[model samples]
Target: MGPLLLVVVVFLGFSVPPYLTFDPSLSRLPPPPGNHVYYPLLVAHVLFGTVAMVTACFQIWPAFRNNHRRGHRLTGRIYVFAGVLPAGLLGLYIGWHTAAGPSVRVANLVGSALWLVVTAIGLRAARQRRYGDHRRWMTRSFALTMSIVLSRVVNTVAMIVLMPQVDTTFLGSAELMRYSAASIGPWLSPLLLLLLADWLLERRKPGAARPA
Candidate 1:
């Protein structure tokens, strides 16, 4: 498998099983108190998000797309409809209802919204036979899709850096430090990844010199 696919698979392996158990105790973040629908929405989001991640590998695999055009198209459709669409919508609901605090809510809201919009535009470009545009947009979409992985990394670093300052900066509230770290992950990861994607896309343009 390509490195990207391998990374995604490893991420899924580590992250998805707990949710599959349908046990609230296994959730990475606790559901909001008295929010009857929160757990269910989170589960649905995870299931569909898994679909998106898996199918996205096939959609981006050059060998598969080049050698098996029909399969590529099929997987692309699955990625859009069955994967991102439901996942993105469910994520919005979950984000809105999360107990993680304001920064996290904003991050989730913006990230989910951007994922949906970028993917939809990519699909539209593909339908219009604007392959270049389609590719660029989908690159951004994929970056957003994989931002979850980067978010984890960012969260870890943020937590480590913030931990030392908890007493002074966070007023000795460990919970506040944790929430602050959590807040950085969702938005910062996607923002950085999207910028990277844009840079890569620009370099691939016609007449641009290939990277050494």
Candidate 2:
């Protein structure tokens, strides 16, 4: 089920780039309060988001496969260099420039920090040869990576649920739903994914809790 969901997510992750282009002007707050960093920050956001999503998809194969080969190590190194580092930096930058309320900004900041921490812990655990710890931390990191996918899912659901009662046009309703999704989506998605991953991991390998 997880793999199936991940396949659907990967399809959407790849599909979104063609259908949606970032418009800097759309990020600006109206009239008196304008966020100057909005456009550049959004550009950075898209850049790093693409990096993170693509690389993250490659990071989990070893967990599902029997062969933990040199290629896995090389890919993991690349993922850390190409995905995790840039994601942490860009996420914090974009979070600072977020146009929404403080709550949204704070949530994003927390998520970004947690992403960095989990990635760092995972790497450190691997270096120390604590395979179980490494697995748990990597699971946490991947869960964070799924935030982008889950955010879209939440937005789609919100649009479906909220659109029918309103008289708004499809585009307007979608726009509103997107905003609602972005605001709260990042906050909830990572944590939810973490819990789900932990539950699944425990079920699959009850001895996964044992020390390596």
User: Each candidate: what lDDT?
Assistant: 0.92, 0.69
- Residue pairs with colliding backbones in model 2 are none
Q: Pick the candidate with the highest TM-score.
A: 1
lDDT string, candidate 2, 1-212, tens digits: 47855674676566445324565434332212465654555555556666666566656765633375676666677667677777677778777666655667888888888888998999999899998898788888888877767866775676567666444644556555546545667777887899998887887686566545
Residue pairs with colliding backbones in model 1 are none
RMSD in order of candidates:
1.3, 5.8
TM-score of each: 0.96, 0.72
Error of 1 at 100 (Å): 1.0
Instruction: Give the local distance difference test score of model 2.
Output: 0.69
Q: Give the RMSD in angstroms, all C-alphas superposed, for model 1.
A: 1.3
Q: Distance (Å) between predicted and true CA of 122, model 1?
A: 0.5
